[model samples]
Target: MNKLNIDSLNFYFSKSTDVNDICVKLKSFQKKSHQLYKAHKHREAKQIALAYLELTDSLITKNNDDNCLLENRILFLNRLCELEKNHENYDKAYHYLIQIEKTINDKPVKDKINFQHQLQNSLNKAVIKNHLNMPQKAIEIAKETFKENISSIYYDKNSIESLSLEADITKTLADSYILLGKELNNASYLDSAFYFYHKSYDAAKIYDSSAKSAAFKHNIAMTDVLMARKDYKGAINSINNYKNTANSFDYKHHEYMNKAICYHALKNSDSAMYFAKKLIHNKKDKCRRSNLITLYNILSKEYFNLNEIDSAYKYSKLEITSFEKARKNKEKTFQLLYNNDFAEAKKLNSQIIKQENVNDKNKLIYIFSIIIILLLTYLYLVSKKKETNQIILDLKNNNVVEKTEKVAYNINEDFEAEILTAINLMEQQDAYLQADFSINKIAEKLETNSTYISFVFNKHKQETFKQYFTKKKISYIIDKLNTDTTYRKYSIQALAEEIGYGSSSAFTRAFKKQMNVTPSAYIKSLSK
Candidate 1:
């Protein structure tokens, strides 16, 4: 079971349509299937469960209630229960568990021979009740199960399986308490939730396997509870306390995201962005869409607050895209559960079969459409880049000319020389190396109106105030990078800070525009 590779089963099941084909494949891959189910790959687990049910329906007529066949039905039913519960389809989960209960009753197994199976049946029932928002009912059933299985307390805690069962029971109780707390809006109930969650963590920590994975998740839930109470600092403390344990279980991404949310709630945008960036950098397709949406929103707002419009727009687009996709997936899941019955799922699958050819044709059309869009986007970007390059070249070659327009301000040659001298003095002193430097600030220092300053730059320098200021700052940074070895070793953010460019991305864009290469590329060429 430990050596099973569920991921490889995907290849064999890729185009399977017939129940018999799916059943044969699943039978050979049962161990891997369970492993996948435990890892929360719910879609794959659901497919296997449905295929098993279809095969069982076809075989039960001939087998006449074979114990092995019935057992397989029960296994898939429990997996279905878990899958439905995870999708928040509580009624569907309850239906699956009710079927499990009926199957177990018909089998009439002795407790000594099937204690674990019976225990799981009871636990699944309680979990579904909890998810249905009946916390008291869930707790009542959970306590009854504990009373019935008191002997489990004497079981070996060092065994991973035994610890996992204990952890499951404790986590369920914790969840029940948490739900009750939310329903009643009672703070005291949270104390009980924490107590049981910690107990679950302790039990799970006894083994370095799936049990420990549960521990990390439970610890993170505790932080969520703190966050719900508006205790952002407490949430941060919990995260720090569990950081080492989290890293050991590949939970570092979750930790970083939770920390980012807590910091965002505290209005610490800089700290929030740091953790958000950490989460985004290592994100994978398997990452939850909800988390990705939240991270993107955080980044967008943080950058907007910092006055980095380009960065803000970039993340805002990502947030909107991911959010729409997430919403679509949610809709599909809701549609699947609209009937809340296995027969409806089978009927849906039959409809899918009837529509397969049409779907395939639509898929081909989608693929071709995507290809055309990507090609056009590439061409458009290339054209835009060329246009930007030409503009930069013109700026550098002194070929830029202001459009001729009548103005009442007569440009005296003497006044023009004074303005140019003042600009030169400011440039020599590196006055542009300030985050808030603007034409208005410059006008105040030069004892003139901002319009007059803008007029001087546009008429004499042949550039807007912003363009000339950016050029001067970028030029200064380029000189430092070429001559100062220590400055060259600085990170993009550090260099941006030293040169007062507001942000590294802004600095990078300006450098590329003026020098026809990125700052990093320019530094690399210097090394060459």
Candidate 2:
């Protein structure tokens, strides 16, 4: 990575969603992981973790939360887990998991979830390795790193950040424990793994992250994958969902691996060689390196499939080189991230300590006074300004106006109609009637800036928004006066209400304010 590209400054300090840049930062973090693990470097690691989390939070939160940023999402998650693991921060993990699970529940990004799951699985395997006696499987699992995070773009609410939080990773963690239990030959370890997995799963299940698909479909897909793993031909029937999903490559790897194993069982050298070669080439990361190498031991298998002994021998020689290269790359990336993370952590701690000791009361007072002056100036100009669509947008700061979940309007429709339509929609929501239903509130609903809404309203409406919006309410009152006798049933106070009014006195005040007459007088005019 270029030195300029990789930043050790910390996550929140850098506000970018560039995955490559994030990856570079993560690589730097990985470089420091080891040094930070040492006794002296512990504070350093803690600081790096703090800085990493701050960035994670800042990145996750945006003016408009767009979770389509798959890599950033994954990196945030990955770093969170790594930080928690080093610190034994189950509470922090729980918090992070809450955010992740909420995203998972809210969005339907299958590809992104798969990447998340892969990282999680790697973590599960790592934790279980020390406790379990399955050295072989643990070593085999270690090879399954470097899975790139993928994003799944579904419908509007399908983005993770847009969703409400629900925690489900606990179940995934539990499942990993169950698998670990089976791998453990010792019954005691099995029980321990079972208890842990059960606890995790129970907590996770409390979370409800429903896919748009039905619960039955989830069961069916899960069952099919499990069943397919049992019978090769059965997999041919059951594995289509598994084979075609975002995790298809994983299924394909297993399929080819199974075919190779079956061919070997049947002593069919010709068939085994074809599947074996395909496995190494296409499903490179899926199969075990030892099993991959053993294929070369079968001199007869290679010749039969390729129709040339020499070709078989060439592939056999290539496997070791490929494995070694992959291993070296992992080592290099891991080391780089570890070193950077350690250094940044130490720097971060020093900075935080320095900041804690410092005070700036005089400077703060000066800043506050400036802010107050600026605010008063802003309010005065706004109230005094001529009201137009532009003025309205400006008054409300564009974003504070009422909004619909309106897809962004096109360039062609820049008129009063659009603003009217938006206002009407908000009115329909009874937003205008609410006490909190100010221009700012509306702009927030529309996800635009308050100033921009005021601009549009002022430019097109030709009247100040306050006056215009009041006119609309006055018009509504007139409509009620003409159409609804329900207004007459009340006293001047009651009559004010048949339409929308907070209080009888407010109605009288507004009626006189708008019509220059009381509600009682307006009724007498109608009688005449």
Candidate 3:
């Protein structure tokens, strides 16, 4: 199949004046975009769909009374929503879904075709909501859509399209139910989830969609693994069974991750580490942030169990970084939804006033409620900023340095000298650069106990072991950041990793406590 060229599309759209010719071109573009999407060329498909939307918007504005053009506009929006949802760009998907909902609402459902379009819109909304973790709302929408589908199927029995819709709706219900069950720990909800999963699988088989059948089958197996908490052996068997049919990247990732979890639970550290490392080395780029976090955590624990302190610390830091990324993504999604909701509220308020049907008392209450919400949001942000500022101020005022005066201890002078010499040797070797370097490790190296090392530090060094260790590490990093231009070029995460810190935030806190400035500020000062 020939791909749609953007240049040719733009040129033809610009030159064409005939409505019939333009509509035909748009239909052709739609088919091409769908074909690319089916072929898994999502990026290309999105580009074509976006171009189609832009062209359709222009045509609709010029021909506002044309129902055909309006219907095509809805189709374009729906396609964009599907593309964004598949990419896990939930914010963009929700935006397109809102547009689709508004378009469908503006036109009455005059035929079975329009009713199907409305059902599709509802299904997309429910799926997006579920992805955003609003499972209850998702379930409500899915159930409503399922009821509509059943009604349509009663009249149009033996319709393959109806079976396809049934499969999609039930699968959505299963997913939402699972999420709700996990959140609330409700056994009934889990049972309902399994029921819907089986229903979805049966419908997919009847619809002759092998891909959908395989996907629902994987879902069932994974759910079984998750619920079999103490039965690691059973979980392993389920994962092995699913592995035979796991052709997609996501399915295979789940298979490996579950296997690693089961083996780790079974006390097979080597096998667990092998599978976890395989995931990282083979599919790191393609893996989701959450999956990377899980893999890193598994590897960290396995290495810790094997007494490989350095490897354990490295993977722990990676897990922390992945967790931070996932948190930021969630925050971004929430911010997008918050902004959209606020705008929608304003739009609804305007429509109510324009209609002039609402009484003044009710209008006052509605407006007042919106004002209160805005005020609360503003106050929450201000309070968060104040808390952060107070933390920085406290850190700046607190002294981390050891006192000059030290008290005498009853311990033998010869043993104190031996501990001091061991510490000096370790310092000279730069052993503190290891993240897991601690009093216990030093004691093990010196063939002594941690109590003796702690005693020496407290009685002679005038500081605790942790304080002394942190001071050494932070001081070294400070000197490097000042003199090494290459160090200044690194990101905070890279800088933290360089000094064996598990998280950038922890490094930032230490830097702030030591230098009374954040790492970024210190780096900026070096540039100046």
Candidate 4:
């Protein structure tokens, strides 16, 4: 074993005179390792932790009778786990967690200490699984651990240890739920996440750890900012308020990330890019793979916005590489676990086969369902084609007005007529040609609220404001296509942009809906 060169850790590799001496040295080494970790000297901290682990293992081997050494071994393993997890070396971290679990299981369940160790081990495993992107498995582990031990742990909530444990478990549950919700796009799962996060906050408060409470509180506020409310400014305010309270490297890193996300959402790309680059370039702190991916994506987008094609492409490639590395790491860790447990692997294989059989049945049903829907859509489009052709003929003949039966509105007829006239004047001026045009803008020009304009649109035009606006834009574009040969020569993208649509796909969808044929096909027919 190599000596770490620190005065405290130097004795780690040397032969000790007695078990007591070794135990004292181990304590010193553990304390020094924690101090190094808190100081952000992760490499030195890991070295010290590994040395402690080796020393403890050898001591345990020579003196299996000492329960103290066995407990110290678990501590060393947990230290290594924390170190590895901090650096995003999740496979190594998971290996250490598994060692902790085996160590705990080998011991006879005698006291609350062993039970606490077991619960902590389970929490660590769930956290590692979550980091590995197996959030459902994380959730299952957390749920099972809690369900199996709630009676024992719940009764002692007044104890700091119990409260801390509860906070950790609930926080893990919330983290898992957040990941699951994002993966599945389920609001209910996100709501469950918030509930658990609040529970975590409550527990942490009683645990009397300001850092822990602040962390959970930050989680809730950030979740609301990012997922639920999407209040970007509010997110920035929350992050700024709590940033000084971030005691750990993880929370500090999150502060940077959340700031970048909020700035990006607010269209402050420069600020976003600066913070993103700050996090990426910080050598003392390693970013999580997911955060690395997000930062790369932000940098790529910002560079693209500046028209720096090379820089954008560079970060885009980096984003993809980071994503692939994360995915492969998860697979590798999962395979490591699978290879370690043959019976579990066999069971998983059986389940996979059953799932495949069910999927095959579902595939056939989906294919038939798609075919039926396509046939119905085809018939609908055929009828719509006739209607569109008639409208196009009328446009060519300068007879484009279509009448709708007037509907009663709560607003007086004079007010309704005035709103209609304002809308017609805006349409005549081709105000919809602006890409940012909206009902609100029209309402502003008319000195009226959007609600009244929306009411008039719904009641008079028999369509919502959006639908009416889309029809007018499409109708104007169709008229241009009929009258202007130059319009037919433009590419689909150019045509879309000419009519204030952001992308060709959006234009094509709207054109197809209006004309029952794609813009490209319609243009080709006009050319013929």
Candidate 5:
């Protein structure tokens, strides 16, 4: 069948409709379609858009003599691509994008219109690849053009088209870099992501409110990259500086969520809970269900830490309900927004299930070990307390201060004093109790470097940083067991949570390495 002649198509739309008339009609249709889309009338909006496209399509001549006609057709094609992408019709979006590319390539010389069209094609194609969970492909597509045109993009910031394209491409590169970095566990990729996010912000038009809002969002995303790297202090500092910008951009909910996460990372549970609860009570309607689920999960954990069992249970149930609701109400229109992330999460979940299935025998053995430990714990607690007191008394009588070991070499007086003071401050402040605590964090707080902290532990403490820190924290747990009968009754998991370990297995391994005794053995011996 022959394709219909575009010149003869008419439904109150003339065969001689000029480019300006077609554009005006297209814009009006777009405005109405957007309203319908927001109202969740996607079918009606799609039908209207298809009907409107027929008129817009007829304006372009086959010869491509009219520049205005070609430009208008390119604009319509880009709009259709966006609409299809939003609908999660990736194949259709790709088809429209291909047509757009063909139209742009049909023009031999690189005029202003041709240049912008080429950039639009590159940006759309890269974004589509990203949504398909092909970060490497997205990176390749973006870099192919971005590397060549970067100088031109930077210098053409005076024009809206150039500035918008630059901002869009840089942001896409930033997102691709961060996603790939997280998947590969490569710090260099995260650094590049941050650099590009900053570039995106710089390329944004200062006076355009919409552009500035996007820049603020890019900055917020950079903080998330910092948190992923376990740079909690850096994340907190970033939130403090730009949190207000979120309000100006009508993104106060995002500000609240970021602040909650940062405070939780810092172990300031009270502040975390304050911000989280504020969002739930005041701004719940304004936030996405997925985000609310995250807030609920955070609240549950924080309340559990505080031993507020009722609040913990409440939020835990809320977390489950929120998750189910989010899944059920998943908006297809925004699928492209988180398609790569969702796919990645699904892949991780599948791998975890497969691993669990393969390790069934080890899991059984672990369960039996836990049962034995529980049985021994019960028997020890039932034994006579007089024997326990006698054993403790004997140990007290035999206790003496052990001689300290000398460092590997004589250190400078100033360096020695500085290191000692920093160690003392760490102990006094109980910084080890933070969930995100690390040698790097301590170094930052002490105004030194990780290399120096690692050196101090090795030379003065006769251990690596992990060994030294583990011994210090485990020693405190031992002291608690000796002094408080209630502490001894706590399960290994509960004890681990109390002491800021991410998991009971991690705590157990550290305790055994430091004291040469399993936690269960230590608990039983104390009771005996």
Candidate 6:
């Protein structure tokens, strides 16, 4: 063994000591939070407030490990969220608490037990809405909590017991705000949504929540141009805010969409169509299906006005299909109203008029209903058959299989079990998973187009390589970023590139597509 000395160990430790720096950061966060309170851009202010409140950790650095900071940590964290309310991005306000939970566990202190559950509850409320897809609601929650966190300067709880209970309640209130904001944004209420997002940003900024003030500002600037109907100003502002941030192309698409809509409002059909087409053909995964659908509908109307019947008809069909996919869920709803809302409404109105001839009216209604149901069912069956045929067609295109087996397993050399084991071997070795692991890399190890490898992995894993790798990347980033200061070196774009994306914008769009939260917000969770 090499000779080791206490002097050398102490010297190395001193070089990395961050306690003083942490204190300065903490105080700065506090000052910023209070300053933001006066601004009352409810969302923005709250994030600033949080940026300050999270500085409590300044007292607990460098293996000093005083258990006292736990209560204060919980306090600042919860307060940060309380201030954010449900300002669209509020769910992120509680992300810091998740880190607090892990830290407390490491401390092995029973007194901090309640804070753990409180943090979990906080996270449950503040997390970005994926299943609900409710952006508008998220905004509302973030705005409210932000104010609360800012205003409450005096806290009476002194005992650990009282602190624990208060933390839980505060955590819940903060989380509620975050959840609401996410829903609001998802609803396309971009202006109001961003206002709330600012709230979460303000609160998280004060404390160690994943939410951040800068990110909220970036989103606000972006959404204002795209969703608030303030085209020229929004576009100009977004360019400034997004210049250093991630998602430039996707962000620009929103501005383009807004301009397209503006041109349509001005009766400039050519300009309108140009922007609409750009949105439709955008390679960014951030393209909202709703925006595209609306654009298609508008384009068809414009073409109709120009007497371009073929173009009109084509776009109209696309609009109908988009609706069928989004609202009717590819006609899985099979509701007559979805198929023919006006006709269904007229039938119901007519039923009242023919009340005197009850039997005939009922018979006619029944016949119509039956016809619609049959038609819908037939469409559904045909769609399924077509889908089945598509798989066969794809196999034929690849020339991988000889006969079409509609119900057969996706078996080729691609989905073999041996391939997955090799991939899993690499995954298990890492402390946290790496998303950048490619089929080619795995194949190289096995001495085998990662395409075939991924095919095998997914066939065996029942997920695409992108999906599996992305999830792994997300899971690792989420956990590691929360507490590891060394991670600060990586930029938001770097996160994507590290995870095998061609560029930052692609990674960001893909992440939002997969995880629902932007890269900036995700990074904030770490420092929070």
- Candidate number that wins on TM-score, 1 or 5: 1
Superposed on all Cα atoms, the candidates' RMSDs to the truth, in angstroms, are 19.7, 32.1, 19.8, 18.6, 18.5, 21.9
Better of 2 and 5 by lDDT: 5
By lDDT, who's the top model here? 4
lDDT of all the models against the reference? Answer: 0.71, 0.49, 0.72, 0.74, 0.70, 0.52
The residue ranges of model 5 lying beyond 4 angstroms of the native Cα positions read: 1-20, 27-51, 58-70, 76-99, 102-110, 131-133, 148-160, 205-218, 243-248, 267-528
Best first by TM-score, ranked: 4, 3, 1, 5, 6, 2
Badly placed stretches (over 4 Å) of model 4 are 1-20, 153-155, 209-225, 247-252, 323-528
lDDT (Cα, 0-100) at 193 in candidate 4: 80
* Candidate 2 local lDDT, residue 167: 19
Per-model TM-score on C-alpha atoms: 0.51, 0.27, 0.55, 0.56, 0.47, 0.31
lDDT of 1 at 245: 60
Q: Write the per-residue lDDT of candidate 4 for residues 1-528, one digit (tens) a residue.
A: 222235544454343433556676686677667767766788898898888788888878887756667777788888889988876778788888888888887665446888889889998989988876789999999988787566774447578877788778888998888887767777787788878887777777765545444564655445452544466777677777664555433566667888888788788987897689778867767787767877877776676666444345456656666655655666666443323333432343344445546656887999999999999999998979989898888898996678987554488788788889988887887778767788898788778889888888887688898887888888988898999996776667657766678778898999999889999899899999
Q: Residues 358-425, candidate 3: write the lDDT tens digits.
A: 44466699999999999999899887997889888888899556767644457778878888988888
- For every model in order, what is the number of clashing pairs? 0, 54, 0, 0, 0, 79
For the record, the alpha-carbon RMSD of candidate 6 to the native fold, in angstroms, is 21.9
In terms of TM-score, the best-performing candidate is 4
Off by over 4 Å in 1: 1-28, 37-46, 84-95, 108-115, 128-137, 151-163, 182-185, 206-218, 225-230, 241-243, 246-248, 273-528
Which lDDT tens digits does candidate 1 get at residues 89-158?
5667778888888776655444432566777789888887775567888888887777666665445557
Please provide, for model 5 over 1-528, each residue's C-alpha lDDT reduced to its tens digit, 9 standing for 90 to 100.
001232333322332334455555665555555555544466777776677656555655454565655565676676678777765566789889998888787665568668767877988899988776678889998887676455554336566666777778888898888878877999999998888888878877453634547656766877878976878889878777675566444555666888888888899997898788667756333455556766877887786666544345556656666544544444442354454534544443344345445556676999999999999998887796778888889989999668976445555678867877777787786667656778887678767778777776677777787776777789888988999897776667657756669678899998998889999999999999
Candidate 4, residue 129: how far the Cα is off, in Å: 1.9
Cα RMSD, model 3: 19.8
Candidate scoring better on TM-score of 2 and 4? 4
Better of 5 and 6 by lDDT: 5
